[model samples]
Target: MTTSAIKPLTVLFFFLAVSLRGTNGEPCGTSSIQVQTINTGETAAGGDSVFEVQVKNLCPCSVRNVRVDGGGFATTVGVDETMFRPVDGGVYLVNSGEPIPSMGAVSFRYAWDHFFQMTPRSLEVDGQC
Candidate 1:
C-alpha cells in the first residue's frame, strides 16, 4: 500500500481499538460512595428525629465486606444506641459477608427519642471489599 493509504488505515484501526475498549480513557482501580438522608420522623422527645443513610458504589468493580459505624445519638447526657435495623430494603443492616455490586445503592433508617436534645451527632458508615 502507498504511504498515505497505510497511514490512514493505521490511524483508523487505532481509533477503533481504543473505542471498543470498555470505558475508554476512564481511570481504573478507582471507586466512590455517595451517602444521603432519605427520611425523617418525629421523636418522643417532642422533636423531629430520624436517621437515614444511603450508600452507593460508583466503581466498575463490586465492593465486598462493608461495615457501617458511628450511628449513635449524642446528647448532653451521653451517647446512646438509637439506630435500629432497617424496616425496609432502603436501610441496610450491617452485613459483613455480603458483597455490594458495582454501581449499586443501599439505604437504612435510624430513630432517636431525644435526637434534637442530643449534641448534634453524626454517623460514620463505612464499606470495604
Candidate 2:
C-alpha cells in the first residue's frame, strides 16, 4: 500500500479505538461532578428572589444530557437559566442540550413566586455522555 493510503487508514483506526474505549457508559464519571449551592436563601414575595445551584463537571470526557432533579422544594416557580426546564411535579431537570466539557460548569437558578424554604432535600444529577 502507498504511504498516503496508510496514513488515512492509521488515523481512522486510531479514532475507532478511542471511540470504542470511551463506550460502556464509563466515559463520564459521576463521582467527578460536584454540586454546590450558590444562593444564600433570599427572601421572595411573588417573584422577588431566587435559589441557585451550580453543577461542576470535572470528568475527563464531556457529559451530555445533563439533568438536575430537585427534591423537596415546595414552590419552585421557574428556573432563571434557559437551559433548564422545570417540570410540574417539583422536578427541575436541566437538559443541557450540549455536552458539559471537562472542568466546565452549568448552573441552575430557581425563581420562586412566594417565600419558602429554598433548601432542596436532594439535588441529583442524571448526566450521561
Candidate 3:
C-alpha cells in the first residue's frame, strides 16, 4: 500500500482500539463484578463456618443496584442490611442500591454450614460514567 494509505489505516485502527476500550465513557456490565468468599478463621456459635464475602466492581465507571444470586444463602451471624440485603427468594442486593465507585468493593460476613454460591446477577451503571 502507498505511504499515505498506510497512515490513514493506522490512524483508523488506533481509534478503533480506543473506542473498544470504552473511550466513549460507556458503562461496564455485570460480568465485571467479582464475588469472592473465604474462610475467616472463626466459627459461629452454632458450629457453623464463618466466611467473608467481598463483592467488587471491576468497571471503570461506578455501578448501583448490584444484585446477586443468593440461592440457599443462610447465615447464623447477621449481616448488615445496608451491605447485603436479601430481597427475594435467593436474590440479594448489595451496597443498598447505592453507587459502588469504580474499582470499589463491598464486603460482609456470614456464618453458615457451607459457603453459598453467589454470582453477580445484575447491576445498573451509575450516571457518573
| Candidate topping TM-score | 3
Candidate 2 structure quality by residue, lDDT tens digits, 9-89: 999987776653444435544456566665546755574567666667666666665544455554445555455555546
Question: Per-residue lDDT tens digits of candidate 1, residues 12-103?
Answer: 98776554332544322222444555445645253546655555656555654443433452322222223223322233233332555667
lDDT of residue 12 for candidate 2: 99
Q: State in Å the error of residue 51, model 3.
A: 0.4
lDDT of each: 0.43, 0.56, 0.88
Using all chains and alpha carbons, the TM-scores for the candidates as numbered come to 0.41, 0.51, 0.81
Judged by TM-score relative to the true structure, which candidate is superior, 1 or 2?
2
Give the higher-lDDT candidate: 1 or 2. Answer: 2
* Candidate 3 Cα lDDT to native: 0.88
**Which candidate leads in lDDT?**
3
lDDT of 3 by residue, 57-84 (tens): 9987889999999868888989999999
Candidate 1 segments whose C-alpha is farther than 4 A from its true place: 1-31, 41-48, 68-93, 113-129
Q: What lDDT is reached at residue 104 by model 2?
A: 82
